[model samples]
Target chain A: MRCIIRLTLLEMLKKKILYLTLALTAIFLIFYGIAMNYGYDSLRDAEPLMRIAVSGQFLSMGIYALGFIVSFLSIFASVGSISSEIEQGNYDAILSKPISRYEVVVGRYIGILLVLIPYATFFYLSIIGLNLYFGDGVVANIVTVNILKSLSVLYLLPTLLTSVGLLLSTYLSTMGAGVTLVILYFCGMVGGILEQIGHFITGEAKVVLTSIGITTSLVIPSDIVYRKASSILYTTSSGMNFSADNMLGASIQPSGLMLFYIGFYIIIMVVLSIRKFQIRDL
Target chain B: MMLETYNLTKQFNGKGGFKDVSLSVREGEVFSFLGKNGAGKSTFIRTLLGILYPTSGMGLMLGKPIGDVETRKKIGYLPELFQYHTWLTGYELLYNHGLLYKMKKNEIKARIDEVLKIVGLEGHEHKKIKQYSKGMKQRIGLGSAILSDPLLLFLDEPTSALDPLGRKQVRDIIFKLKNEGKTIFLNTHLLSEVELVSDRVAILDKGEMKKIGTMKELLHSPLMLSVGNCSEKIINELKKIDPLLERVGNDIKMSVERDNDLPKIADSVVKNDGLLYMMKRKENVLEELFINTVGEEDVR
Candidate 1:
């Protein structure tokens, strides 16, 4: 198991994609910092405008940046975890050793997360640092909350995505798995919106549509978690507002219940993935 | 039996893989699994190594069920078209594999050097696998397989990418391991290599065991025989002795039905005023046996 983890980490670290991701992440942070400074300068005299605009912009940037980073990284990292190796016939060499398939799956997931955590941490810190430098003084408590929320979402969301990716990669070819997961990721993003539109038309029918959307989101949790995390980061002390009508409407900050749902979502996806992989014909 | 399969059948959905294939390989022997491309050679190796599960039936390695983790500890494997992490140097790959086998770091380092030397990859240890040529990668792969001195080693086309000298080097290492009491399960299409190294060989075609036995046993079977040149009239005379006798060009080919009849045939041919060009026993070589049993259509 340790060998699998070591090998996974070593292999991922050498991939050009990892460096590309890191470079993109750094760019996101720099851009966010500049954007926050410009917004802060515009409303420098108005305290309420300064606070709302700066906090809202920083929150939005954090959500977008981290969400995109985690989604992109998870897709790139996990989609080929098994399929590429199997395609290249490298798994033959590994499985021929005294390791079980379960170990390989679990070890690879953890290793990918290990690589992801550092990037997430860097982005989370960059957002908070930019908020302090440009906006109000570092609300250590708020920053801590925001960072914790982002980290949890980072960890839980990718775990779900990685599990889905691993499950797909186990049976499909690399390209097939990759394209399927990308489609799944996008569907998950639109799922909630589709459900709400269904609700506006009918009630009981909406229940079924909502459940379907939730189920789809559970299968690929990137959008669900990202939206939930975005809502949480944007929510202020006043109240949760996701309405497009209110110009001041900020996305709801993820509440305790939302966080728990994300956690449960991640666990269930991981368990399903592990079960599927154990019985898979690798 | 050091390794055995019983009624093992594996079938892919549309296409077939292996079916009710059964054979045994004894300890300290070079057992060659002869098959052409997609002849279930790799599928069998994968099943034995726990890379793939059989649809039905059973196989045992080192007295344990096939693919058993404990059984794998005592086994080593080299895939036919092996791919290693290109970022890793030859030494790192060996070291990493050594660690998986639970070798001490110091022991792994020492074994790394020894195996590198054994595979003739001594100085190139520091070079990344991507930098190595195909033959060099194969040598490195072979080195890793034998790194732990496993009780059993499974090699799939172990010398497919090697030149003559490299192939000889691989064969020598296999032979040395066999002499040291390691059971080797070699899967290869190289019949000459099998004939040169195998104590026993199994011919597989269309996922079935077509033939299995020691080289000598296979050679002495009715499927093989020795013939000497004799006069056409004598060939006609021998036809009286045996209905299977036939003359082709300058030589008389007689199929020996029994071992005792060999001396009689030799004497008759000599007395017939014919020169014996050669009297050599022939068995289907691994390649011929594979084709004959598996059918030529299966060999891509």
Candidate 2:
């Protein structure tokens, strides 16, 4: 399994997708860097409160964008990790080894994550460093604890996407899994909207909408994770926003159980993937 | 026994997979599977390797139940038209294969050099698999299969994609592996390869093992005597030696399972005043046996 992990990581690096991802990330950072260097000058010159609001806005947006990039790369790395190889008859030699099916899938998953977590960390933290360095002390107003909290929550996003991607890869073709993941991504977005809808409605209608949101959350907790991470920015709040009160996962107050449930979702998907792949004809 | 299958069948599709394939291959011998396209040769190997589940019966590989990790560690496989991770360089592919077999890093490094040399892929290690030619790909595949120096090696069409030179290169490697006391289960359509290397051959036709025996047993050529000016007495003399001797066209053909019988037939032909135009043993006897077993239509 260690060999698989090392080989898979080496293959991913050789494909240079990681480099391309980093290049895209660097370009994104450079664009944001420019945006901060000049675009925030006027905001900084304004009242201090306005500057704080502007910095909060960019910080939240940057976290979401970074999360999306990491999630995309993680999915791409894993979506074809099993199904495509089975189609091409590549697993015969590997499975003939002295490793279990679970090891094959887990080794691959860890390989992708090993690359992903570090890349996500670098991108996630660099933007923070850049904002602090370039934003004329405006971005420093958000508590460091909040930034770290948000970053930690944001980290789960890709791991969750990769699990879902590998789960679908177990039974579906590479393209089929990719398409299904796209639909699930929409479900996650809709889940976020439903979570928002639960805030404004009341009575049985409120119960129904919240139930639907909860159902979607259980089915695909990735969107719930995104919302919960945003809520961490302002734990005292219930809505998803980049306000100073909710700038670092503070007030939106989703139960810790939901986060653990998301983590469990990752484990279940991976286990299911291994079981399915173990019995597949290829 | 290196491998023993008792009624091992994988006919889930009930269309093209093999059935009731029971055989025993002793250690350090080369056993070959000869069959036409879709004749269940690959199916048999795959089932034995546990890539495909058997619907019934049992298989024991290296005296352990099939698909056991301990037994797998003692086995190697080169799948038919197998695909390699193309982005991987040849050396990396072998190295990774070694890792899968749980070899240490330094052990894998040493084995990679040895395997690459054995497969005649010395300088090509650094090149990525995608850039390799078809023949090169096959050689690298062989390299990975032998990287662990497994006790039992299953090579399916190990030379199918190679050119003549590459084919001989593979044949030589198979010979060398056999000399090193590896039990090889080879699946190939090349009858000549079977004749040259296999100690035993199983001819599979339409998912059935139609015939199987030692190479001498399967290719036991029937003595063909081309004669003219033959008389009834000469025919009677030949018949005495081989009760089933038959005259076809201008010659008398009979199974001369013993070399001593050859002399008696020649003496009978001359003493009885029959002109022995030729008394030659048929070459490519395995080819003839294969065609006879599988039928001529499928061979073409």
Candidate 3:
């Protein structure tokens, strides 16, 4: 199993996609820092309350982009983890060893997370650092506890995405897995936006939109993760609870029960991936 | 027995995989599976190796039921059309494989040197697989399969990517491994290679086992003779020796069960005053057996 984990890490590190992702990440951080600086300078003369709110908005946008990039990277990195190896006949030699199929699935999941988690952590911290450093006096006084809690929640983004991506890889071709996971991610993103919009309106449509959001979260709790992370960061850091008017923040704080469910969701995905790959004929 | 299967079956949606394959490979024997493309040759190997679960029936490898993780430690496989990890140097691939086989770190290091030497890729081990040619990639794959010095090795078309020299090298390696008491299960459509190394052979066609026997039992050199006489007496004399002798044009082809039958045949034809143009045993006995067993149709 450790061999499998090592192999998976070696594969991920050697792939060109990792270098490209790092290069793009460096550039994204630079641009985000510059954007925050310009926005803070432009809003300097504005009312204090307004300046803080807008600064929070800038922070929310940066976090949103961070989550987006991390989630996609996790998906791209993992969707082909098993399926491509199977297709290319690479698994034949590895699996024929004394290792169990579950080890391959779990090892790869952990391996990908090993790289992605650190990457997501660095990327998450870089965004927060840029927002705090460039926002001057406008950024909120984010305590260490809030930062740690938000980082933990942010870590779930890749863990959850990697789980789902691996599950798909076990049962589908690489392209098929990639396409399905990407579409499901879009579904989660759209569902979150719809639920946010639902909070602002009143009628039968509002209930329908909220129900759709709840259902998509059940399918993939990706959107809920981001929302929960932001809810923790903003509500704790600025004593400003999420409202529908904050376009970039969570419209409604997800319940504590949802976090437990996401944990269960990731476990179930990992378990199912192992089961499917075990019975499968390679 | 190193490997045995009883009524084993694996099919895709109830078709296209070998069925009811019951065979046992003894220790220190080279058993070759002869089949055309899509003949379920690779499928059988995969099933026995536990890469694919059997739809029905059972198998034992190294005395454990198939799919047994512990049992796999003693087994090795080189899959047909295998695409190895091309990003790693050949040395790394073998080291990783040895680790998967649960070898100690020092054990792996020592085995890599021996494996590289056997596969004839000694100095090339430091180069990434992607930099190697197809034949070199195959050699590296063979190196990894034998890295653990497994008790049983399954090589599917092990020489498919090799040139004549490389193929000869593979054959030499197989011979060397066999000399050390390792059982080998080879899958190939190359009849000549099978004839050279196999103790026994099984022919599979369209997911069905058509014929199986010791190489000597399945193959027979039939004698062919060109007789210039058109007399019934000459035909009758030859018929006395081989009752089922076949006449094609002015030639008589008869299966020879023993080499001593050749002189008897010539004497019979000469005594009858038949002008004998030629008398020679036909070559490529395995090829003839294969064509006769599987028929003359192309593999789909």
lDDT: which candidate is best?
A: 3
Cα deviation at A130, candidate 3, in Å, is 1.4
Q: Sorted on lDDT, highest at the top, how do the candidates line up?
A: 3, 2, 1
Full-model lDDT, candidate 2: 0.82
Pairs of residues clashing in candidate 1: A231-A252, A231-A253, A232-A252, A232-A253, A232-A254
Per-residue lDDT, model 3, residue A101, is 87
How many angstroms is residue A5 displaced in model 1 relative to the true structure, after the best TM-score fit?
1.1
Query: Which lDDT value does model 2 have at B188?
Result: 94
- TM-score for all predictions? 0.83, 0.91, 0.90
List CA RMSD, all candidates: 5.0, 3.3, 3.7
lDDT of each: 0.75, 0.82, 0.89
Q: How do the residues B1-300 of candidate 3 rate in per-residue lDDT, one tens digit apiece?
A: 898899999999988899999999999999999988889999999888888889999999888999899888888889887677889999999999999999999999999998888899989989988999999989988988898889999999999999999999999999999999999999999998998899999999888888988987987778889998847888888788889989987988987788877788788888988888998878788988898888877642
lDDT of 2 by residue, B15-44 (tens): 779888889999999999999989999988
- Cα deviation at B46, candidate 2, in Å, is 1.4
lDDT of candidate 1 over A86-126, digit per residue (tens): 77878888888878878887888888888877777777667
Q: Give me the TM-scores for chain A across all models, comma-separated.
A: 0.80, 0.87, 0.96
